[model samples]
Target chain A: MGSSIAANQLVWHHDLTGQVLDPASLNLFWFELTEGAYGQIHRVKAIVEIVDGSAWQLSFNQGEDPMETELPVERWLSGRPDRPSQIEVVAGVDFDPIGVTAACRVAGSPMRYYSIIKPSCGSSHENRGYFLYSWQL
Target chain B: MKIAVISCIHGNYEALNAVLSDIDDHKVEQIYCLGDLVGYGPHPNAVVEMVRSLNIPTVQGCWDEDIIEGLNACECSYPSILAEQRGKLAHTWTDQEIHPETREFLAQLPMTLRVDNLAFVHGSPNNQHEYLLPEIDAFTAMERVLGTGADVLFCGHTHVPYVRDLSDGLVKVQVKRSGVSETATQIHVAPLKRIINAGSVGEPRHGRPNATYVIYDPESAEVKLREVEYDYPKTCAAIIDKGLPAIFAWRLARGLEYAERAEDPTHICER
Candidate 1:
């Protein structure tokens, strides 16, 4: 893959509950990881984004705790085109002391889940115009 | 021998699990997957891990190749600019989300796999991006299917499943041997050659939301298409929570086109 710039670090409130997101409205969002008894994160991954009034949902999990979220179309459009806007982070996030503390940064912390390599990295490597991160949520 | 084939599992782990459970109930000797272990859905890592752990023989699909060989535009027939953009976004996310080991597994996958007389590929035998639609011409279809030179060719790419049997006309074909002084020998063309598309296990576009797969019974020369329903609502909600495009979540229940969400107010996005 071609090397591109890293996504800017943005403060995000990971939503574990699937009900907070409204499918009617499109937006950018991400999910919270569910840990097994062994402290290993489960393989569930979720992301829902809305574009041109149509919402796109992508999640993969066969086991328990399949988390969901809703990124309202407005908030998805309000960011600096590179980051999600700070608004309704988590509607009813479970009480996790670590997550709660991590969510309290005054300035945005480094993005933990945004390590997507830019798409313009291979044979078609010259058209390096605005390499967007694939994760809209 | 009874063989099971699954393909185009674009990360909908629920569907994959359901299909696997269903496959377990049947008595099959060998199971083969026709690539595309990731892309589209959210659980690329899990899907890759499951297939790897099971030790299923798999051939790489176009999307799998893209994910492994540096993300690029997919060959899906998404019509609109918004759809194309969303598709690209999903691929990119999958590239980032996949485990390095999984990526390595996909990278080393062969474009086609053969066992005895059966051949497996993601698209056609020659090109991974080729779409062997059901309505293709007999001669054109024969050209690609014959490239494998196998008695039966099994592939998945168009997602919609079907079985196409092309019979080679009975004729006396002449063959010359380099070491022999005899004239060309005459032989009859073989029986009907078959192409079986196993369809998509994660996402189905055949106007039904059930997960799809195929079981080929060599003894009876039969291809059985199977569709099993899983927990789609959970998947839809996960997609939304993960912040992927909402339309993907909305379409799982109906197996309808992306634009169909607009016409029906009862769609998941509307609710």
Candidate 2:
């Protein structure tokens, strides 16, 4: 676990090595969640940029049009029978966790998170891993 | 007899709750599910337990099979890397989160269920992953579903709602978009063979964020395509909270397909 202060907000962080992401591999996802009314969980509204290693980023901004990419991520999200209104990020932030810090707004709000770091398909067998993380406000 | 058919729950408890409540309002005599009880969303165990307590007869979907058999990945047909990536996350999380009893229910689920002249399946009578799309040739579709010898076949996999009538020599098709009134689109089938894609209860792909199912009244010989609105924000939030893919939660509000496919503008019938 690690702690950093940003904009008078004490943000808590965790390195999922050997926990969510395989410690032996050089790939993993870093994500954050926010708590909502009535104890519902949501994604932390923040920008994620990879400073080191390879990172894959997918973002669903709150009140913003979903990005138009090869995949209709927004349309699919809207089409989900559950009808989630909050923004979410899945495996968007993919990178090696040795020196990565995700900038998230962690003041006064509670959130939960889970991520995975596994081997890519059609790739050679390697020491791949899965990882998870949760931060409650 | 009036039978309510639901499919492609994908583990969203809130959506299932709404759909089930709506079904109750309809006062259907029997309820059946077309498989895919878990996948994409959160609350796999909760959904499984509810279905079990209600004792809804269900068929096996590809995701259910993946969880029961401990498969590495779900049989989702997404061509995009991002969708594939998130799908992997959903499968992995759901595989771990499902209750053992849920596993048992999914494990013992039959691939197909026949009731008199109607057949229920997750995808098609032949394969759980096989899609019975609207553009499928009528004869080929007939051959695929004819194995059960049921004149009316109901299946769900594509998450889209459609009805195809292959009676006589003509192939009539009906695809319902979201917001279409339930009464306006009531299907009265003729003596010709028919196939109905019941759509998804947990995840809809018809560009609508409502939970969908089918109400087939044998007494009236009518099929009603019903879409009910649920607390999507609650379910979506639960998905992210459970550490599943955020995309899975985010996509539920839009009600559209995640993957892209080459559009075939022309509808051709194979002889």
Candidate 3:
């Protein structure tokens, strides 16, 4: 099990890519990190922006256990019924021995990223990837 | 023999009654309606029963589809939404306001009608939602006519009367700028592909608040757009007494074009 950190608690460490992102990008890094004897888990917050400027938030938790070592991720883009563009993950999670990778790829292009989390479990485990985001004007 | 094409009655029983009375003198052989028998105006069942009694050949319109179906069944403009809501509200009146048989008839009406070489529809042949207004360009008009294989296409959704001829390697849009006057003007139809909007019988949009209809002669190939003044006060009173929306009555007083004016960006006031 995992828990996401508050937006105020997350520190904007580095851009890493030096790409210009929106001020609202701060919400991307809000995640919680927990470590246990077996492995580490990360809980990420999902944010959705509707065409009417309405925002919806969902919580997704990723846990690492002996039976399962990955978390789920979903992303979507553009909520307009006339024109819809979305990105989502059906199964699996992203796992890295040193850090957890959460990337949002929209319309064949990557736009946002979440801070990486290193699992304290071990280096032999495989990482799972999942994310979703949707935007509309 | 003179034939009248009336459409978009929109349940305005008073205006429809007045127009029917005026046309009774013409001795018309047949009266054909181009759909939209109910919407915006007040009496749905009354208008439906009146049209049914006439035994006129009618077509289905977008408004009719919405009332019988639902709003999401088709796309619509903002004013169309208002008109549809008013129609839904009118359902609260007497049960005789909208008979089940009338609804069945409206649902069963065809989208297109072929009377000899003349084609009839609620809007354009290409799309029932489109409005073939007089102000539109000739090329666009030609596209609409070409989409249908009829020599003459009669339509009535924009509530404006005009003729478009697309033959002899030339396209022309003949617009009736004024309503029927003391001296009646005759429209000569050539042997070519043409699109004609018979305008509205109950509600006219062209400056003139009078009810409009067209008399089409197949033999002489002539089409005459005629307008007759009705008792607006009686129509307004009926609408108000029926508890219909105020915009319906207000628009009749001004005769302000709704469909065309809404499309113009400069005419934001209408929006």
Candidate 4:
């Protein structure tokens, strides 16, 4: 039964979001891992262009946080501190209503989700956008 | 002679059974399926076997592709997750339900087929991933149908039946109001390229739970959309017994359509 079943099943996999570390003191980072399996080690970078001409950079490393010294100690040690699985960068832009461009790289793998989050100022008064760039590993 | 095009069984053996019983007497020379022999619905294996027994020319729908090749996993909308979960359940119930032979059969189905100048596609011809509904104007339909080079194109992804005529250089689609009961409906308009959705055989979105099929005669250039009543109780029971999604089975009890919330990306349950 196992052999018959295995023959019919089709295995599917996707790339994980590359690690991005934020050095800003007030920003935050979160990682949402893919469900099933992981692929080869691929490098990814996100260059976030702030409205005020400032920019933030996030990078991925296999066993260490590339921007560990720059991130807030509390958040940097919050989840999976022992082994840096993935990285996320949270930055605040002072520009009242401006857009940020994010570009990610995973070598041969494709980036699944990317977006600029604009937190609400108390009463749902901010606009934001999410874009996904997906490709095979 | 009349030809009924039905696709996307997605399990739901009862619905397929009901539709078949309803059309048992109809003089259908050929019955075409738009793919998705299993998924979401109950009795994936049973539904596949039945469609195969009927000898209908079935195409490989997106849902079918998901099961066999994982083509749209990243893009499978939220409702699709629920639908996929149901498929996985069905897969486990029947010992991985679909066999290699069935998977191969489904894989070989043409994405698009032309019968007497009418092109039949499970989704849209331009992109099998697209869902072309009747609500969109004829211009959108024309744009999608531009290079297909068919007098008529029939699709069934939205599970909603509609007709669009793009002959007079103006695009116009006739939206069949849901819940209108009619034995036979006629579409009287000449079109350079016509778009028609045959609706769903296993699941009908219109308030009435009757399975729907479209009969078109190329020789006479006449088309009629017809609905046949089926055994809803039996279908619903099979769905329930299989421990499928309660909504998946429950929705069939009443012909009310499922509405997907805007925030939800997966709205497969919504008709």
Best candidate, TM-score: 2
Better of 2 and 4 by DockQ: 2
Candidate with better lDDT, 2 vs 3: 2
Worst 10 residues of 3 chain B by lDDT: B262-271
Off by over 4 Å in 1: A1-137, B72-78, B169-190, B257-271
**Tens digits of lDDT, candidate 4, B58-91:** 7778667667665333313322222333344554
Q: Model 3, A76-113: lDDT tens per residue? A: 23332232222121112332222222222111112122
What lDDT would candidate 2 get against the real structure?
0.61
TM-score of chain B of each: 0.85, 0.85, 0.79, 0.78
Per-residue accuracy of model 3 over B1-271 as CA lDDT, tens digit each: 7788888777767767777876687777888899888765667878888888888899998677766765432102322222223344543442336678878888898888887777898887755556787667766666566556678889988887877676753444454556744554543334467877888876778877787888888788788887878777676677778766444565576564322222221111111
User: Over the stretch B64-168, how does candidate 2's per-residue lDDT look in tens digits?
Assistant: 987877554311243322334456567788888877888998899999999988899988887776778888876667776566778899999879888888876
**Which run of 10 residues does model 2 chain A get worst, by summed lDDT?**
A18-27
Better of 2 and 3 by DockQ: 2
TM values, all candidates: 0.59, 0.61, 0.55, 0.56
Query: What is candidate 3's CA lDDT for residue B182?
Result: 52
Model 2, position B26, has a per-residue lDDT of 91
Worst 10 residues of 3 chain A by lDDT: A122-131
What are the per-residue Cα lDDT tens digits for candidate 4 across A2-25?
A: 122233232222222323222110
lDDT assessment of candidate 4: 0.52
